[model samples]
Target: MERLSKATLPAAHTDGVTLPPSGWDTQRTGIVHMGIGAFHRAHQAVYTQDAFAATGDDRWGICGVTQRSDTVKRQLAGQDGLYGVLERAVDHTGVRVVGQVREVLFPAEQNAELMARIVDPATRVITLTVTEKGYRRNGQGGLDLADPAVAADLAGGEPVSAVGRLVRGLQARQRAGAEPITVVCCDNLASNGRVLKRLVDDFCAALGDDDLTAWIASKVTFPCTMVDRIAPATTDADWALGEQILGLHDEGLVTAELFKQWVIEDDFVAERPAWEKAGAQLTDDVEPFENMKLRILNGTHSTLAYAGALRGYPTITRTMADPELAELAAGLITEDVIPVLECPPGEDLPAYGAEVLKRFSNPALAHKTTQIAMDGSQKIPLRLLSTIRDNLAAGRNPAHAITGVAAWMAYVATPEANGLPLPIDDPMADRLAAVRGSKDALGIVENLMGIEDIFGTDLPGNTSVHDQLVDAVTALLP
Candidate 1:
C-alpha cells in the first residue's frame, strides 16, 4: 500500500470513510495547535476538515506542535500531515483521512519556527489539547512555580513543557505586535479557559514582563471548550487495520469512537474555523457542558479505570462487561454525579448519563484501563472532587466518588497486587511513590490526602470522607 499523502488521497477509498480532496493542502496554516495527540487528531482536526469542506475556506489549516517529542513530527511529516481516524463502533467501523494538519513542529528544535507561526497575523486562533499535567498548574489552577520543569522553563532555556512554549510564543507575539488571537483550551479541567488565562498571567508576572501581561489581559481570549470523544492510543492492530481498509499506510493513523462533540465558548478576538457547521455548539457559556462532561462521563471513566484495573480488566469494554461494575458507574453518574451537575437548558441530564455509560461499554474501542488510570492525581480533582464537594455540602456521603478515590490509592500503593509494576505517570508521581511503602490502606489515605495539591484542605479535614474512602478500599481488596 502507498503512504497516505497529497499524492495518494485522490485514489483513497474505503467502505465507510470519507477521504479529503487532493487539493486540501492548498489551505494556509492559520491555526496553531499544541499537544498534537490522538485525541486532537480525531476531534479538532476532523472538525476543521469538515469546516473547510463545508465553507471552502482554506485559511483554518492547522500547524500542530508536538510538545516534547519529534515522534509525531516525523510520523506526520512522513505522510505530509495526512492521517486516518478509524471510528470504531460496536457494530461497525468507519474511517476518515484527516488533512487539516498542514505541518508539525517540535518546539525544542524549532522554537523560533513555532514562534513565527504563532505571531503571524494569519494565525488567528491557537488551540490546545494538552492534558492536565501539561499545564504545570498547582491545585488552585495557577502556574506551579515550584515545579522543576516550570522552574527550568522560567530560566529562559529551550522550552521543555507546553506551558513554557506558550509563554515564549506569547512573548514573541507581543514583541512583534501581532494581532490578538484566541487561545482555545480543549482539556477537561473545570473552567479550562479561565485556568489557562490564569497560568499565562502568572507566567508573565514571573518573568516581570508587565507589558506582555497587560497585552495578554487586554487582547487575548481563552475560550473554554467541552470536547468529547474516546480516542484510545492506537495499537499495532489498529495500524494494520488502517492499511487494510483504506489501502494506504498512514504512520499517523489514529482510532476513536464514532461519537464526538465539541462545545466552545463563543469568545474570540479573530476568526476561527466554522466548526458550528460541523456540529459544534457555540454558546455564551461552556460551564454547564464542561461540568456535565467532567463529572459524569470523565468521572465514570476514572471509576471504571481504577476499579477495572484492580479486577484485572485490560480494556474499558471488558471492565464495563461486568454488570456489577457497569451498574456501579451508572449508579455513580445517575445518583451521585448528576445531582450536583447543573444541566444546560433543554438538556436531559439523566439521558446524558445513560449515553455516556453506553459509550463506555462500546466493545469496539479498546480504551485501556491503565491509560485512563495513569494520571489519577491530576484527574481526581476535577472528575470526582466537585461532586464529592457538593455532595458533602448537601450532607450526603459520596461513596461512589470514594470508590474511584479508593481504587486509585490501591492501584498506586500496592502495585504488586495486580501482578505488574504500575506505570505511575503524573506530575505527582514521585510524591505518590514515596507513600507507596505505607503499611496500611488508611496510612496511604492519610499520607496522600496530606499532600495539599491533590486532596486540598477540606477533604483531609473531613474525617468522614477519609472513613468512607477507607471503606471503599476494604470493599475492593481481595
Candidate 2:
C-alpha cells in the first residue's frame, strides 16, 4: 500500500473523504506555529485554513514546527504537509484535508532553517501550542533556572528549546532592523501570552541580551488567548476508521469533536490572519474567558482523568459513564469551580458546565484518560490549585477542588494491577514519584503542595489547604 504523501493526494480521494480545493494547493507560509500536535492541527490549523479560505489570503498559511521529535515532521512531510481532520460526531465521522501547514520542521534538528523561517519578514505572527510545562516556569511564573534543560539552554548557543528558538529568532529580527511581530499563546494556561512574554524576556535577560530585550519590548506584542477544542490523540482505530471511510491512507490523520472555539485578545503588533472570520472571537480582555475555561473545562477534565484512571477506565467515555466520575466532575464544577468564575458575556456558567459534561459524554470521541492524566504535576497549578486557593481566600472550604489533586496522588502512588507503574508522564515525574514513595497521604499532600511551582509558597504553608487535600486523598484510598 502506498503511504499518504503530496504525490498521492490527487489519487487519495475516496467516497466519504473531502479533498482540499485548488485554493488549498496554493498557499504561502505566513504564520509559524510551535508544537504540531493533534490539537494544533484539528483546531488552529483548521481555523487558519478556513481563515485563508474566508479571506482569500494565501500569505497566512502555517509553517508548523514540531518541537518534541521528528515523528510529526516525518508524518506530515511525507504528505507534503497535507493531513485529514476527522470531525467525529455521534452518528458518523467526516474528514477534511487541512493544507495550511505549508511546511513542518523539527526545531532541534533543523536549527538554522527553523531560525531562518521564524526570522523571515513574512512571518508576522508566531503562535504556540507548546503546553504549560514547555515554559519551564517556576512558582512565580519566571524562568525556572534550576531546571537542567533551561540551564543548559542558557549556557549554550544555536537556540535549542522553544524559548531559545524564540529568543534567537527575535535577536535575528532585531539585528535585521526591528520587525514588528505578534506572538500568540494557544495553550490552556491563564494569561498565556503574558506568561510566554515573561519567559522569553527572562530567557533573554538571563543570556544578557538587554538590547534585544528592549527591541522585543517595543516591537512585539504577545496576545493572550483562550482556545477550546477537544481534539484527542489519534489512535490506530481512528486511523483505520479514516482508511475504511476515505480510502486515503494518511499518516498525519487527526481527530476532534464537532465543536471548536478560539478566543484571542485583539492585541497584535503586526498583521495576523482574520481568525475572527473563521468562528474565533477576538476580544480585548481574555481574563474572564481564560479563567472560565481553566477552572471549569480543564479543572473537571483533570478530575475525571485522575479519578477515572484509578477506576481503570482507559478512555473518557468510559469514565464519564461511571456515576462516580460523573458526579466528581459535576460536583467539582458546581461546588468548587463555578462560584469562582465570572461568566463571560452571554454565557451562563451553569449551562456552560452542563454543556461541558455533555461534550465529555460523547461516546464517539474516546479521549484517553491517560492522555489527559499526563502532566498532572505541571497541570495541577492552573487546573485545580488556582480554584483551591481562590475559594480558600473567599473563606470557603476548597474540599471539592482537592479531590482531583487527591485522585492524582492516589493514581501516582498505586500503579495498575499488573505490577507495572501507571504511566505518569510528567516533567516532574521523578519529583512526584519520590512523593509517592511515602505512603502517608498527608505527607504526600504536604510534599506536593510544598513544590513551589505546583502550589506556590502560600498554599503549602496554609494549614487548612493541607488538611483539605489530606481528607480528599484519604477518601480515594482503598
Candidate 3:
C-alpha cells in the first residue's frame, strides 16, 4: 500500500472523486477563510463543496489561512490540497474526501502575500473559525488593543489579530477603491459576526483612526452564523484506518459526526456562494438557531467533557458508555436545557440531544476531554454561564446549568483525570489555578465572574447562583 504523500497519491479533484460540478473548481475563488482547523474542513469546506455541486459555482472555493501551525500547510500542500472527512456514526464511517481548497497561506511564510490575498478585489467573502481565544480579547471580552503583536502590526502598519487582519486587508481594498467584502465568523461565539465587528472597530479606535473604522463599518458585512458539527480530534486510529482503507497516511485527515448544519444571516456584500442551495439556511436572523445550539448542544457537551472526565472517563464515547454520566447528561438536557430552547418547527430538541449523546459516545472517535476542556475560561461564559443567567432572570430552576458550572470548577481544581493531567490551557490558567487552590469554590466562581469582560457586571456575584454552584461541586467531590 502506498503511504499518504503527494508523490504516491492520485490526483484529487479528479480521479472519480464525486465533487459537485459547481463553479468551485472552474470559478476563481472569491472567499478567503482563516483558521484551517478540522471544524472548518469538515463543516464550512463541506458546505462550499455542496454549493458548488448544486449550483456548479466554483467561485466559493476556499483559500485557507493559518497564522500558526506548519502541519496543516505541509499536509494540504503535500496532497495537492486534498484531505478526507470521516463522518462517524455508531455503526460505520462515511468517507467524503476531495479538494475544495485551492490554496493555503502560512502567516510566517507569506505575511504580506496573505494580506494581499485578503485585500484582493476579487475576494468577496472572508470567513473565520479561529476559535474563541483567537480573538486575543481582554478580560472584558473585547479585543486587546494592548496586545504587543497587535501593537506591532499597528506600528508596522499591518494588523495581526483575525479582526485586525480583516481590517487591514479591507483597508487596502478600500484604498484601492475595491468593492465591499462580506466577513463571516463561524466560531462558536454567540453573535460572532458582531463580536468580530466590535473587535475590528475597537482596534481601529485605539489606532485613533476614525477613517479606517468608519470604512470597515461601511464596507464590510460581518454576518453572524450558527455552525454545528462534532469533529473529534483525529487520532492514530483514524490515520491507521485511512492508511488501511486508502493506502495513505494523511496527517491532515479530520473525523466528524455524520450530522452537520450551518445557519447564516442571509446578508452578504458583493458575490457570495450559493450555500443556501447546499442546505445552509440563509436567514434574516440566526439568533434562535444560535441560542438553541449554544445552550443545548454546546452546553451538554461541556457538562460531559468536565464531569465525565472527572469520573475517570476520557473520550466522550467512553463517558456516554458510562450509564450514570450519560443519563445525567440526558436528564440535564431534557429537564433543564430543552425547556429553555425554542426548537425549530419540526425539529425535536430531545431527539437532537439523543443524537448528541450518540455522537459523543462513538468509540471510534476518541474526542479527548482535554481537547474539549481547553480554553475553559473563555468558554464557560458563552457555554454555561449565560444560560444560567437567563434562567435566573426568568425565575427558572438552573440546577443543571449550575451543575455544569460546578463541574468546570471541579475540573479546574483537579487538573488531571483518567491518568491524564488536566489541561489548564487558558490565558487565565495560572490565575485560575491560584484561585482554585487558594479560595473556596464559591470564591473562585466570584473571582472568575468578577473579570468584567468575561462574565459581565451581573453574573458572578449573584448569591443564589453562587450558592447553587458551590453546593453542586461540593456534592460531586469524591
Candidate 4:
C-alpha cells in the first residue's frame, strides 16, 4: 500500500474519512507545540485543523517538537506530518486526517531549528503536552535545580527538559524582540498553565536573569486548560484498521473515542486560533471545570488503573466489564468526589461522571490499565490526595478516596499482579523501592505516607488517614 502522504492523498479513499481542507497546505507555522504524542494528535491537533477549516486561518499551522525521542519525528515526517485520528464509538466510527502539523522536529538533534521556530515572531502561541515528569519540578512545585537535565540546561548545555527548553526559547524570543506569546498547557496537571508559568519563572530566577524574568512577566501569558479525550496507545490492529479504511498505510495513526473537549481560561498574551469556532469553550475561569475533571474523571481513572491492574485486567474497558470494579468507580465519584466539587455551570456532576464511565467502557478504546497505572507518584497528588485532603477538612471520612491511595501503595510494593509483572513506571521508583522492603501492609503504607511530595507535610501526620490507608492496603495486598 502507498503511504499516507500528500502525494497519495489525491487517490486515497475518503468515503468515511474526513480529509483536511483543500487549502490546508497554504497554512504557515504559527504555533510551536512541545511533546507531539498520540493524545495531542487526536485531541489538540484535531481541534487546530478544525479551527483552520472553520475560519480559513492560514497562520495557525503547528511545528510539533518531539521531546524524548526521534520516533514521532520519523513517523510524522515520513508522511509529511499527516496523521489519522481513528475515532471509535460504540455505534459509529470515523477517521479524520489532520494536516495542521506543518513541521516535526526532534529537539535532541534539531535544537537550533526548534529554537528558531519558538523565536519566530509568527509563532504567537506555544502549547505543551509534556507529561508531569517532563516538568522536572521539585516537591515544592518549583523547578528542580538539582535535576541533572535541568542543571545541564542551566549550565549552557543543549536544552533537554521541557521547562528548560521553554525558558531558553523565551530568552531567545526576548532577545529577538518577538511579539508577546501565550503558553497553553494541555497536560493533566492541576492549574497546569499557572504551574508552567511558575516553573518558567523559577527557571529564570535560577539563572539570575531578572531582565528575562521581567520580560516574561510582561510578555507571556499561561492559560489553564481542561483537555479531554480517550486516545489510547495505537496498536498494530489499529494501524491495520486505518489501512483498511483509508487504503493507505499510515504510520502516524492514533485511535481515540469520539468525545473530545477543550476548555481554555480565556487568557492569552497574543493572537490565537478561533478555537471557540471549533467547539472549544473559552471562558473567564477554568478552575471549576479543571477541578471537576481532576477530582472526578482523573481521580477515578487512577483508582480504576491501580485496582483494575491488580485484578488482572489489561484494559480499562475490560476492568469496567467487572461489575465490582465498575461499581467501585461509580461509588468513588458519587460519594467522595462529588461532595467536594462545585459543579461547573450548565453541568451536572453525576451526569458528567456517568458519561465519563460510559466513555471508559467503550469497547473500541483499548486504554490499558497498565498504561494509566504509570506515573502514579505524580498523578496521586493531584487526583486522589486532593480529594482526601478536602474530605478531611470537611470532617468527612473519604474511604473510597483512601482506598485509591492504598491501592497505589499496594501496587508499588507488589512486583506482580495476577501472575503478570506489574512494572513500577514512576519517576520516583527509586524512592518508592523502600516500600517493597517493608514486612507488612502497615509498614508499606507508613513508608509511602512519608513521601512528602505525594502525601504532603500535613497528610502524613493525620492519624485517621494513616490508619485508614493501613487497613485498606492490608486488604488490597496480594
Candidate 5:
C-alpha cells in the first residue's frame, strides 16, 4: 500500500517496469513546462528524461507548472516528481518511471515561485501543452484582452491565463537580464508556435510595452512543434492496473498508447535538449508534419469523439470496433483529408493514416470518447473546419468532413445517448445551451454555424455546406 516515490522505487521488483537511469537525481531544472498534465508527463517528460539518460547531461530537468489547479502538483510533488507512464497496447503493457520533472508548482498558489523559475538563468526552454481553450483566444484568433483574467493579468495581478503567465514571465526574464529562451508550443493548433508568438505580441501590445515586445522579438524564439501521443485520462482502473503491475500506488500514473512522437522546429534562442537522440525529429519546417497530424490524426479524433459518443460507445477503442464508425473515420481521412494535404517528407499519407487508425484500435488504452469530445467549439476549427474549407474551395464535397462537423452539432443538441447523460463540457457551452433543446436539425446547424468563432463567416454563408450540414445533422439525430 506504499505510494510510489523515490523511496519505493528501490523496492520495485517488476520485470518490465523501467526505472529512470542513474544520475536522474543530479539533473538540474532547465525546462519550465506549463500545463503539466497527463499528456506532457507521458510524452515530453519521458522524452526529456531519455535525452538526459542518453547524453548524461543533467541540465534538462523540468519544473512543471500546473495552470488551473494543484491536483497534478499534489499528485507528483509527494512522489519526488516520479510518475509511471503505462504504455498500453493490445498485446503488451509496459511502465516507465519518468524523473525529469524535478519540481511541480501550481501557478495559482505559487505564482511568485513559478515566476522566479522563469526568471532563473538555468531555465532555458519553456514548453506548453495547455489545451486549445487555455490560450484564451478571441474569435479573431488573437489574445482576448476583453477576458477578465487577461485584463487582470495586464493590470499586474497574478496571471490567470496561460499567455498572461508566459508574457509576464518573459517580461520578468527580460528585467532580470536572463539569457534568451525558446517557447515550444506542444498544443494541437495549426502553426501553434507562431500563434503563441502572436498571442504574446497581442498581450504586449495591450500593455503598450513596446520595449518588452521588441525585446521578445529580438531575443526569444517560439518553435512550432508536432507532438503525437494518445495519453488518455487516467481512470481508477488504470491506477489499479498500475498498482497490480508495480505493487505500489502511483497517484501520478499516466496511461498512453505504445506510440509517441515529437517533431520540433530546429529554431531555438538558446541551448536545448538533444531531443533528436530521444526519437524526436528536429527539422527546419514542422508545418508539413503539423498539418498532417492535425488533419489526419486530430481531425479524425474529433470526428470519432463526437460521433462515437453520440452512438453510445464509451471509448475510442470500442468505437473503432464498430464496423460502420471505423469506416467513417477511414473515409474521412482517405476521401477528404489526405487529398487536401501535401504529404510530408519521408512519409506516406495513406500509411500514416492507417497507423493512426491502428493506434485508435488499441484496446488497452481506454481513451474515452466523451473526453475527446469536450470543447468541440475550440477543436472543430483546427481539426475539422480546415479540411471542410479546403475541400469546399476545391469544388469538392467533403461529405465525411461535413459529417464530422454535423456529429458535433448532433452531440450538442442531444442530452443523452443510450440512457447516459452526455454533458456538453465546452467553453462556449453557455451560448450553445439555447440550441440544446431544439428538435429541428436545420435550426441547430444554422444557429451553431452562425457562431463565426467556430464555423467562420464563409462556411455559414455557403448555402451548399449549410444544406449538407442540415442533412448530416438530421441523419445523426436519434
Candidate 6:
C-alpha cells in the first residue's frame, strides 16, 4: 500500500490524484464541533477553511467530536486529520483535501478529554449536526429525561446526551469564569436555536440547579442556522471511480456538489470569525431564507425521497432520469411549494428552485433517495409540514406537500420498497408504524398531526386542510 502523504500526492486533481499528508497538526482551535459527518466536513469546515485562507487567522480551526461513530475519528487520525473532498457537479469533479479539521475525538474513547476541551474557555464556538433523533426528546417535544442513557448519565454523575454534555461543559466554563461560547446548531429543525435553548434549559433543570441555568441564560448563545448543500454518500463504486480518476488510495474521501450555502442569524453573544469573507450570510433575520429553503429545496427533496424510493429508484439521479418522477418533483415545487415560500430580499425563489432541481438531477452526484428519506418522521415536520401549515393559514391548500407526506407514509407502511428494505432511521418509526396501521390514510394523517409537539395544537383542528390532505392523498394511490 502506498503510504498516504501530502508530499507524495498530486498538487491538484488536474495533475492526476494526490493524498494530503498523514501528519497534519491537531492543536486546539476556536471551534469545537459535534457530529463529525460528511455534511459538516464538506460544508461548514469548507467554509471555515475559506474564512481562514482569506483572513489568515487560524483561530477558527475545528476540533471535531463524534458521539457514536468511530469511523470519522479513526479515518481522520489515520490521514493526519487530512481528508479529500470532491466538488462533484454534473460535468466536473474537483478534488482537494481540507485541512481545517485539527483533531477528532470519540466520546467513548476520550470522554474526559472531550468534556474538558468543550468546557475550555479557548473554545469560542461549539457547533453541532448530530441529527434530530440525537436530541432524545419525548412525545411532548421536551427533552426525554427518562431516556436510559440520560438516566445512566445522571445516576453515575456523568453527561450522556449531547445537551447534557453541553450544559455540563458550560457549567464547567462558568465555574472557571470563562467568556461565553456561541452554541450554533446546524440541524434541519425550524427555529433550531429555540429548540436547542429548550434542550439546554431542560438539561440544566434536570440537574436541579437554578444557578447553572441562570449562568447559561446569561452567557451562552444558541444561534439558529439554515445550511444548504447536496452531499451524497460515498459508495464503493464512487471510491473505485475516484481511484480510477486520481491514482491514489483514499479511505476518507467524500463527494459533494460545488453548490453550497450557509445562512445564519447574526445572534451570537461572543466574538465570531469573519465568516462573511467566506460567503456566509450573517443576516439579522434568517426566517425568510429559512422558510424558502425549507419549503422549495428541502421540501421537494423529501417529496422525492419517499416517492422515488417507493417507485424502484435508489438514487436521485436515477429518479430524476425517470420522466414521471422528475415531472412530479418539478410540479410539486413550482405549482405547490413555490407559491408558499417567502424569499429574502434580492433572492429569486423561482431561480433558487430551478438551481435546486438542477442540482438534484446532476448526473455526477448520484444522490440517493433512500439517504434523503432516512429520517422522514423528523424531517417532514421541518421541511414539508411547516409549509403545509403555512399554506393552510393563508387559506390555500398545499396539495403537493400533502402528497409528499402521503408518499412518506406509504414508504413507511411497507418496510420493503421495490424488493429492498429502505433503512428507516427515525425516532418515531415505531409510532409511525402504529399510526400507519390505521384503517385509512386519513386515520394515519390524523394520528400524526395530532402529535402536539410536532405540529402544535392549531394544525390538527384545521378541518378544511385535513379534508384536502385526505383527498389529495387518496388520489395518490394508483
Q: What is the overall TM-score of model 4 with all chains considered together?
A: 0.98
lDDT per residue as tens, model 6, 1-478: 3423455354334553433333334434889998889899988988887776677765777889888878998877866676777777767776667777888988776878787887777789999998888888776668898888776665646666787777777878888888888999998777788888998888778778899899888888898898998888988877776665655566777888999999999998887777899899998877788888888888889888788887778888887888877887788788777787776977998888899889888988878888889877678888888778777777787777778877777676656656756666777776767754333667766777776766677867878767766775555432
1 or 3: which has the higher TM-score? 1
Candidate 4 residues lying further than 4 Å off, grouped into runs, are: 437-439
Q: Which portions of model 3 miss their true places by more than 4 Å?
A: 1-27, 436-452
Please give, for residues 306-421, the per-residue lDDT of candidate 4 as tens digits.
88887778899998999988998998899999998888888899999999999989999899888998999999999999999889888898999999999888888888878756
Model 1 agreement with the true structure over 159-234: per-residue lDDT tens digits = 7877788888888888998899999999888889998999988888888999989998888999889999999999
User: What is candidate 5's lDDT per residue for 185-239, written digit by digit as tens?
Assistant: 9999889999999999999999999999999999899999999999999999899
Would you estimate the TM-scores of all the predictions?
0.97, 0.95, 0.92, 0.98, 0.98, 0.91
**Scored by CA lDDT, what does every candidate get?**
0.87, 0.84, 0.77, 0.91, 0.92, 0.77
lDDT of 2 by residue, 1-478 (tens): 5666667777765666777656776787878898888899999988888888788888887888898889988888878888899888778678888888988888778888887887889999999998878888886779888887788888876655688778888888889884699999999888899989999999988989899888998999999999999999888999998877666788899999988889999999998888888999998889999888888999889888888777778888888999977988999999988887778986799988999999999998989888898888877788888898788878887676888888888887766723324587888888878765456887777777677777767877777767877887777754
Q: Give the CA lDDT, 0 to 100, for residue 274 in model 1.
A: 95
lDDT: worst 10-residue window of model 5: 7-16
Off by over 4 Å in 2: 10-15, 417-421, 461-463
Q: Candidate 2: minimum summed lDDT over ten consecutive residues — where?
A: 413-422
lDDT of 6 at 392: 76
**After superposition, candidate 5 runs with Cα above 4 Å error:** none
Q: What is the clash count of model 4?
A: 0
